[model samples]
Target: MSADNAAVNFSELVNKNKQTLARLKESPRLLLHRRDGEDLVLTTAAKAEQDQTVVSAASRMLSAMARREPGSMELLLDILPEAFPWVRFLPEPDVHAFAVELVDTMRAADSIGNNASVAQMLTAWQHTAEVHSDPVLLAALTQDHGTDYGPVRHP
Candidate 1:
């Protein structure tokens, strides 16, 4: 299949998964923390640490919104990329600025619809940036499952 077709198919899948998408229409704070406490515990300690940092950052942003403190918003944006590596993939110049703007918009006292544009953009950016040029395991998994795939790891 052509790259264009593949891109279209991916887009269709994403659209279909809208309901399943967690960050599509909610604040990062609202979407980042899962209700499944056990699932969080199952993640590696390092990953859980990173997740906790992101959660703390989100909570700070939420507090800033509640107090309408511009400085807190600025601080939140400045630390966001460090707290969540995925934010680093956002397009340049606007990445930091847009993060603060998104939180402010999403948490506006009078706002109706959830504003998750930043989260969606961050998710898309991470997805596009992290995808390997050659996903060896994915290619192998597509073949017959019983086929000898050799050792799972290389020294």
Candidate 2:
């Protein structure tokens, strides 16, 4: 295939993936939470809004990074304000440790052929959580998302 053809194909793939994501976002299971202590179960409208927010944020972050902008990190951080403040409280090295754990989880999920795309997208979430370690962020991640990284628990 020619280089131009390959580029077109790649763009088509990205668009198709976006459409699929939109459908998934419209599903009933997407969870929505606000910074103002309000949580809403995902209805169709709420899911669409949340989906757009997440997709737009992800796209902007990726574009900023691709442009090698110095402010890319800040832009990425702004999209996830809930977690950014926590990084200050966490020991610096532990941030990367959480990222490693999340990577392993993604690999595991991929090995099982279980929603590999979503699992891969979760790397961004892990990255954000890894950097920020405030009590509120940690608690929200652990309690709400089941991402406990504390002591081991026996079932």
Candidate 3:
């Protein structure tokens, strides 16, 4: 199914399963219950730790990108193929150039009161282009799953 239709169907399902959804929304880390009525909090701790790790990794990646570190482009390229499968066929130097251009654009955009990250800015730009230029958008207001082909990973 198209993403937009899937989203509508998913929203309908969520509305139908409000009770279960409420529990999930209330405590995403609520993973288990003990026999003595006490709830295990380890899961919550683990989740928080994982989140912090991701943030830390992202911070390091962004710093490297900003500094134009030697290995930074390689790291970025590694994730690009997974996120944008077409990048798998692109030459390493080309990918590096593209990443550098993207990061520079993101930095410039952030300086002008638009503080979105590189990924966010790229996605927004592509979305805008798809909306304005893609013939599919004219035929049907379908969702563009540009980033849905693969897993998003820390650079």
Candidate 4:
């Protein structure tokens, strides 16, 4: 196939994936996870306005993550791992360590703010997490529509 055709296919794939994720985005179950050894509890049904706020914040964090923008690390922390309950089955130590390292790397990248480096870091993160994570869980995390899943930077 020509390069142009490949690009079109890639774009179509991205759109299809986004649409699939959008369909999966609604009514995500909230799973509790301990933060600092204490359970961080949140419920989407608390109030309509609150739910909207949560969704908006999550969307912004994801955009930042995708763009590799500055301050993305802090935004990432705002999202708890429990937010993506699907990963609950994975060993906490592995996920927690990965989250911590991700935050650290994002923080370090902020000092220099190199888009290429940030992109590389995000890719490495995805690969590392995929290696340690269950295939089904990883797919849900990457391909599903949920705040807990972070951003799907795949094409």
The top-ranked prediction according to lDDT is 3
At residue 35, candidate 1 shows an lDDT of: 42
User: In candidate 2, which residue ranges exceed 4 Å CA deviation?
Assistant: 1-42, 45-50, 53-56, 59-63, 70-83, 95-155
Query: Model 2 Cα displacement at 84 (Å)?
Result: 2.8
Error of 3 at 68 (Å): 5.7
Q: How many backbone overlaps does candidate 4 show? A: 0
lDDT of 1 by residue, 26-119 (tens): 3222122234342111223555567656655664567566457757556767777786676665555556555655555445421443335546
lDDT of 4 at 27: 32
Indicate the worst ten consecutive residues by lDDT in candidate 1.
1-10
Worst 10 residues of 4 by lDDT: 1-10
The C-alpha lDDT values of all candidates are 0.49, 0.48, 0.54, 0.49
C-alpha lDDT of residue 129 in model 1: 34
What tens digits encode model 2's per-residue C-alpha lDDT throughout 1-155?
A: 22221121223334675653454344544333345555443246665567556655554445446346656544544444354445444464644444344344544444454545545555565566464545776666667665668998798
Per-structure clash totals for the candidates: 0, 4, 0, 0
Clashing pairs in 1: none
**CA deviation > 4 Å runs, candidate 1:** 1-70, 108-121, 125-155
Residue 25 of candidate 4: its Cα lDDT?
38
Across 42-92, the per-residue lDDT of candidate 3 in tens digits comes to 224566767656655555556557577777667876777676655544445
Each candidate structure's TM-score, on Cα atoms with residue i matched to residue i, is 0.30, 0.25, 0.34, 0.30
Q: Could you tell me the C-alpha RMSD of candidate 1 in Å?
A: 19.9
**Candidate that would win on TM-score:** 3
